[model samples]
Target: MKKKAFKEILKYVRVIVFFAVITILVEAVNYVMVQPGYARYIIHTVDNPDDGSDYDCIVVGASHGRASIDPHYFLEMEYAVNPINMCIQGATVIDNYYMIREACNNNDVKKIILELDYQYWNKNLKRDSDFGDLLVYGQLPFTSLKMEYIVSQLMDKDFRTIYFRRYAFAKNWKTAKKYMAIKKTDEYKNFQIEGVAGIETEGPYQGLGFFYRTKVTDKKGKLNPSPWTYDDLNPKVQKYFQKIVKYCKDNGIELICVTTPIPPSSVVSGAANEADTYFKQICDENNVRYIDGNLIKNEILNVSDDDFSDWEGHMNGELAEQFSEILTEILMKEDNSEYFYSGYDECIEAIKVRGNETKVLKYIRAAVFIAVIAGLVKCIDFAMMPSGYIRYIIHAAGNPGTEEGYDCIILGASHGRSSINPKHMIKSGYAKNPLSLCIPGESVVNSYYILKEACRNNAVKKVVLEMDYQYWTNDEARDSEFGDLFEYVQLPMSKVKLEYIRDELIDKDFRTVYFKKLAYTSDFSKVKYNIKTKLTKEYRDYDISAVKVCDANGPYMGRGFFYRENNNDHKCDFLVQEWTEDDISRKVIKYFQKIVDYCKDNHIEMVCITEPITPTAVVKGPSRDANTFFKDICSNNNVRYIDFTLLKNDVFDITDNDFCDWEGHMYGEAAERFSGIMSEVLANGNEEYFYDSYKAKIDEIERKKS
Candidate 1:
């Protein structure tokens, strides 16, 4: 019996150990994945006071208090209050109560200002699922109170969400890359939030927990108030509010409840009066002050729906400042009834929603109208967008491993597309099957994604990267042009595409991504043509001829090549793009390295090459620097560097006459010949066909031609 009992205990111990390890791993991943955001910043600010000064008053509530309360205003107006705003977005009464406790624990708080939004007091609402709640919970100091809070609030949430906080956020490989980089920083480790706070649409997060919202309501007077009744006051919320009151009383802290101003349109016809009466009676019972901003007449606080950021009545930054000033003035005065109406009915009579917008049918009609408008806008955006070469190339690539996948793929900008012929390479017995995935105006970063796109479908054994010095630029104007946007927009929806967007295009103007027409100036005359073309079966199937215009220089050739007609008599006056160490973009280096690394990881051979350019006047230092830069990169990565400009004139006789223009985009005949030569060299792995130096080749050509 004793031996059996011991064995049972051992079994339980083993199970516990297994779970402990799993729990540790889950927590570790959570630590890394959950980025340092506003919650961490705000909590750190209040919990660990930088000034080491006691706050005279601290505001605790949800987003309304966070945006509306400006503690600096009180200081500026010579009020004897040193305040900290501890309001959080989507914070419930429970969150507020804990925030109050946290503030009081850290510093000597003389008073508490609680902002009330009756919508948050709904009994049916589940607070655990809120990302805001999880963020705050994750940032809270590990204490008995925290444990209790976790048991009360977070126990019912998904274990993944509780342990791996990023589960609550949009989980993607790209977002992981972003946050992983963030995790490596000293700022993140030190819990610093100074430089990185707020988003593009939202204004900056001012210190002391105030968020200045820059966006105003576009809806104007058309607002949907969160309809609430007096009975909607949650029992749990009341319990916490009462706890906050009792805690404040025991600590000898003055408690003042204030309802931050909302647009009159957000106030349901009679709901405001119900909330006002209930809050007033409760505050009166607790012997605390209750001031409702909704009761403030239109004369003193002249605000409309325009002052708000949303229909829910979150004030914009400008309105917050104005309201803060008024709030400070009221706090200074002993009796502030002059600024406010006697009751909610009087306030509603003065400021009300325009027209009969409160009806249910009106709301339904408005929603339907907005939906229709959105759909029409999307249609217009789509119609105005032109079909570019990228769509053709991607479509031509076909699905993964389609029809005995190509072993070789060429990737780069237009030079590769126009110069190298996959057909000629195959004819010369170089590669069994190959595809040129090159795009016009493609950046090094874009080339990496193109390779990824190619590899996903085909069994890629080799990648030939065409180096264009002009495309290796850090300038946002140079890299994120319409061509780049076109390439991104055309890629099929896949993991690779999503990762590319998250990693590369997340920061680009969203309008450009969603509405491709916005990135380029559309010729209004072609609108009818474009819309008609897009509607065709050819366009839908990505027929190259459907979109391609047969210009003088070239016609669209299948397998991602544009066959250019030779212009032997064309003048060459354009300068050769000079490259220097100083001019080298870090973005170019990063993406180039990524390509090299990817090739290595996948066991695919990557060859770096520069296509022949017209030997125009060379800017002395940059020519040599360009050769050195590329050579060093290839050598460091143990890859071959082939500079076609350094090809021996005897081996491949090409001139300015062979190219369509000064950029050295080969005409069809010359391109075919070069492709044959490329195939021979690549098949034989011969370096003797090329000169040792770029400058030497340029000088020899210039000397011979002269």
Candidate 2:
């Protein structure tokens, strides 16, 4: 009795262990998959944040600081101070405070040059900015600072958006996107050799650390000046401004707030002037040094109205060159003493550890503990709630040995899934065990990828392709069940899945990669089905007798097809629908050719069969074009093409009653008959027993037709 009780307890323990392991793996994978776009400079700064890394004198602020200061200038001209322009676009004073604190921690810093852009003070300092703080977030290693910042933002700002990678990357998404998209191109490959980080010295950006916007006007063409006043100082920002002073003073880092040189029009308009006066007052109160660019804009910087194009100084590289030298001189003069460099490796290790560091995973064990209790008490369901289709996908992912290999493979959309019964194909002595690799809404592109996925584990020799008539023209195949979910989530995570995401899926939904386990649940039916089914094995059973899988969410695909089962009981007409060639995608034709080529190259015999469509549904031009296209591709590739679209015989005659619904997928009996016709054709020969004539009475039907 004790032994039995021990065994029962062990079962429960094992289940708990499974839950913990699965949850951690999901969270960890998601965290890695969503590692915000890695930029070269950002990575170097984060990884080598020490004296050895040569990032000694750090400059921090918004676009003005970024464009105004050049680290390479200091590295080449001064050789005393090593710096990186740590300024990002739209950076606020509050942003600078945290940045300063992090930089001090990460490097053995001598001084931090702060950009006192007055307009930045207008922003509410207590909140996070819409600007790309994610660049900093992605750059910073996991540290107390990062956690504190995350917590503070969560408490004060948009709580969920704080941890959201998409929201954080909103501003720079275009840059990151372009960088990723061109990754495979020869141009991109050649570009990578030039190095991703450093000064932009070649193109329009003739200077390091900034883009030199050519002066369009003497100061007027694109001279857009901001409407600012001294009284417009955001009170919350004033408070944080003082906090930065205290932090810098206490940390023994000399902080110099500088008002950068801009166009004469901005100063004349009272916006830049009034802000400058206010900054001096704040600097005087904090006992910090303040540099006035307006007083010395002409003398030291050598700038004129013609050179000053815009308020942001998007005009002269000469101004940047001169201004960066002055800033470096100011740092060189401040105390004239260098900081003691220690913890070179340690600082970088800490930053690297902190930047991509996450504590969310550490709590998984505890979460599972709480979750186990809750699950037992019906408090909340675990992520274990997967749809029937998801269940099949998850099962297909690990792919036990029983499912790895195959003799015959059926691939297509609902028409083929419902039409080609795998069991009938085997029972009729056509092939051995055949797995129906069909999903609803699959286009030609989707099928090609799905077929590739099947070929990974299965040693497939014969491919029974259900050539959807619409696929010939329509490249955009959406599944009747989960739409694009099966196109991705159903397949195990692999390079093929990533390729689907990168090349095919137009939206580039990262959630499919990051929140993979829950990505499909965003849709209504799938969410509801997952909740109802709880990813139960019973609802996701591979019916051994039928040689098909039943996905609860994929109602039609349960019979190993991608559509719901029916017996011609419910049939409704749509408002207006007919097959048309106007919407045909040339990509569909290309994919068909690709599929045939893949089969031939891999030594697999391909049999292309366009399953029967309802007589009423077929439009003459559209249907004929689809059939011709399918036939042409198959013939060009030496694959036997069977056109069952004209199944107008006695036994294989498809009536309105044969269809399951308006979509034209046939009922069980019709599906069985279609499968029988397919099997007999392959078993004997396409020319002899394949046409619309039934195999049992082919002679009589042929005579009648003659």
Candidate 3:
């Protein structure tokens, strides 16, 4: 039994050793090239040998603290204590508490200056600490403090990223290459990191981050501020703030919580005042000193827009110098802590504990290998999904409804889709149940099947084909056309969807059919993280945005009915350009014939509609443009043709005011008016279709114009 146990122990030791070697190698690379922040912090710590011992006073906060506090201000004043501004952008109260905790563990500190911003409390949400901790963890040393923060605050994914250096460094390979090349520069080598736990680093103005741009306009000029009434304080921030107070009291470190000076443009109505009131209450409960900078801005301090970098609160170097002087005077007069942070040698102990290799951690090594492999597979599959915007066409194509009847179905591009409202059509008695299916930047080739599907099982009594000269000139594969997945991604995996893919996409865009993400890959940009987060994730439900036909109430009234509020901008400025249908894409002519044939075979009433454009659209009086061509085709085939392109006195007049949103779509009233006109035509049949001789009317108008 003893011999067997010894052998098992030896096996475990070997596994532990294998992981230790890999971890050391990964961490060594991570220290130099994992994340920009990681490299910056490690270098700062390595270069600046002194821990928190050098700084008797520390200023801690977010980007505001880094940019608005001048450490040299205290150094120049030659106060009883040395000070360092330890700030990073997006550092919240939880992060601030960790900074203090790390500082107390390593530094000789007499006082702690917390630079609080009201903007931090503006969010009513419980902060997404998983994300917030990304900024905090990169610079933190692997101490008990860091371990606790990681365990309690970080998500499993974040924990994996931070603890496993290889995992953290893999995603940013290209960045690592560039950083490795530039990281050895003079500024990087000489960069200073002050304060315990290395919270402070090199800055721009005399090595201070505090400064403002001279050419940039005051940001407040761009926004129209309105009163924002809400009393929901961020619960997590309050909890962390209390924890910071307790840490200060327990350590015998004097703490001063501050709300920094902010300009009017950066603050919404009464936000600053309310923030100050809340902060005052928190301070009173804990018996900590508090400074409300907004309350004394012009009276005690004369900072202006000229002194700020932007409207959202950051003071320039000159203003920071002045602010620091005032702050120092206040602290010197009021500070009560005489004893400094002198006992803890937690840094060495932390290094030892972090360095220790354990047997159980070997399983984490095995798990990392498995998780990484699994994640790679998931990412590849996720890239293949077409459930985003393409879902609209898929949902419509795969619609399981068997009712083979629609009073009318409008087919074209986005204009055709949005121009006609099904609810209004039904309510006005033009078409009992209408479905407007518009796909942006779609070719008529796609619409042929879309219309066929719309009419498949439904008793679509009428077909309204929306067309303009442009609809007949699709020569190129539009960037938005984005071939295959638009047809296949959203469709249910069945013979019908599969056949459509094989017929429409197999030879059409074969490469894109396989690697479709490349279809719009050229549009991808390396935007900043903050911006990309908002753009990609916000309001991104394609089903809600794309599907216009909703029978939620009495058929989705006023849902897709859109009109530009301050219209009447002579929207027909396109009249400035000459219109022509002399060049129609062969594809358009083919689809037009197909539509007519399909309608006739199905015994469906086809309305070959020339949708209204701006007044200067195709000159219709006597010209042989798309309108005349469509009219001629409809006349030969005995189909009803209704041309509504001109604002002529005889038939219909659509002006800029008639269009509510864009180039040629009608407003609600205009749509209703047009719907009424169509209803009259369909109801009256051949005798009342044009209300008079349509061809004779066109010839009369032409004769008069000539």
Candidate 4:
């Protein structure tokens, strides 16, 4: 009887083990068959090719660095150093450290530029700790580690999801199959590798949705820290950060910490200061070379906070160009020769070709893995289906649009569009016929689609691009609603433009909302008061004010003023500020070159014009420098550059009240006088070139008025 009972128990155990094995096998198979689109959230596709040795100096920071640094500018400066801006949005010090580690591990990087802003450190500690630490450990475990970090890693659902998706038996099987298929093809083997690094690194899916929210005392009150202070982060995070420093030191990779620029308002809030202190302390303790651009108050503070996208703290593209140049100067001055790569051009080419192959394989594997996962999930759901119950999961994915047209399209931040008027040329007869497509507060990435559409339709003659100082000074917004503009307009994502989109557009809004929430906590009262105050202030003051009109014939109402005198006699201030002229000139030239290239490719002519500013405003000290930069840019572009900076002589007879409501913009009477001056310039063509049709058009308009 005892033998029979034991046999029964053994038989039951064997049955249970069989079922477990079957379950595991089925799961593995399912993971292997899923499509990559389904699993993209777990694995981000790197759109920009990573030529193994592409970057000698890699910049890692929060949004501040993203907008403030331009690698192309550095390249133009003849520096072999190609900067890979790995500034993620909402990135904290911990996150930055990990990103640096990951970048160092993947590439033969020498110098790491970490933009240290005060906000990075001043924020609640708990809010600062995020998946960046986990990613750092995952990529370079030997460099940075903590047992508590490991525990936190396990607890993070998103982190688990990414890792599991990568290594699951089913996922791996799918990846393997996809790789095999690509291995069979040689077409993608010889892809042309352009050495130009893009602004965006990964696809739209790279970012984990994290947002931070801090409690304010009242709706109108500034950001307060009391509520967030209580949420202390896990102490183990520091240990992990230290480990990263040690790893870099051990690997002989120079760790350079940088703090990207922030707007004055953000700086005044004390966050920028805190971040500087934090990074300074960390770098000092570790003996790492740290550069804090965020603390460079005068240069950075000049940019207005409103210029930032959605009021999030980051500089826009215009600012990035300037900042990148500054960073290049610093690097050059430092003479860290050990960190510079002499054979960067050769490395870029080789990496480009190799990177394409790697990318194709990666995509194929991702597709297969996702398909397998989807299939398994569907099967399980079907098998477990119950009456009147269903599961639905919807995924939104695809290219936002195309990149093809437009010789030139002006991409401006809030104030950029307000500065230039396409109508001025049309009415003045400078352009017999012209199309102006301008978007306000449009990031460089957002303009991709608009330009693409213009290219496709042959609608753009030449782009009159405007760069706000803020555009290049901050991180790209991740979920910018403006991406909808591309989709709605039907912009094509060409290979070249796609590169720009990834580099410039992808990481906008880098901080995932999840991380932001963790960093900020609030009481109901504080939240209410803050909301109320913000709403009232926004409603009362943020919108456009009513337009004021001046009589054109009376008191020179239509004439526009210039902020400075044209001493060069080149009709602009190109020669006045030669010291900082290169900085501004380089950006304008590059921008126009892009336009010129597009035009040359499509047989279109391009011209650039500088709109008029109030002379009183320009001559009054610092404002004169505005035209100094503008004039230099126009001179370098070789386009028909016009500076109304000295137009004050023509408009001096006009009263200040008639010409401008504020110092810059023309209201009622001033607009009309400026329009008339523009008409004469168009008709005469200044002996450089004759526009008969423009003169004819002006005559027709004048006749109609009579």
Residue ranges of candidate 1 with Cα displaced over 4 Å: 1-374, 399-402, 481-483, 519-521, 550-552, 568-572, 576-578, 617-621
lDDT of 1 at 248: 94
> Could you give candidate 2's per-residue lDDT for residues 335-372 as a string of tens digits?
52222112223323333444354477767986897677
Deviation (Å) of 54 in candidate 3? 4.1
Best by lDDT: 1
- Ordering by lDDT: 1, 2, 3, 4
Could you give the candidate ranking by TM-score, starting with the highest?
1, 3, 2, 4
**lDDT for each of the candidates?**
0.76, 0.60, 0.58, 0.43
- Select the stronger candidate by lDDT from 1 and 3: 1
In terms of lDDT, the poorest run of 10 residues in model 1 is: 615-624
TM-score of each: 0.52, 0.42, 0.45, 0.33
Residue 571 of model 4 has an lDDT of 29
| Candidate 4 structure quality by residue, lDDT tens digits, 1-706 | 8999999999999999998887676546434443222112111111123453445666666666655666665567865455555655556666665555555545567776666554444334344343433333333333343344456455655654334333322245555576344324452222211111121232121121111122111222233222112133244545655766787788887776676655444444434444455667778989987766544433233444444542334555555556667667776676633322233233234334444555577789979976886677544333332211000000001211223322234433323333334355656655543333433335444444445545554445555454433333223241243432323222234564455545443433322211122112234444444334334543234211111112211221111111221122212222222223323333334544565566667665554444444433333323345444555655665655444444433232333333332234444344445545644564465532222332342343345446
Model 3's number of clashes is 10
Error of 2 at 326 (Å): 15
Question: Model 1's lDDT to the true fold?
Answer: 0.76
Give lDDT: candidate 3, residue 493: 53
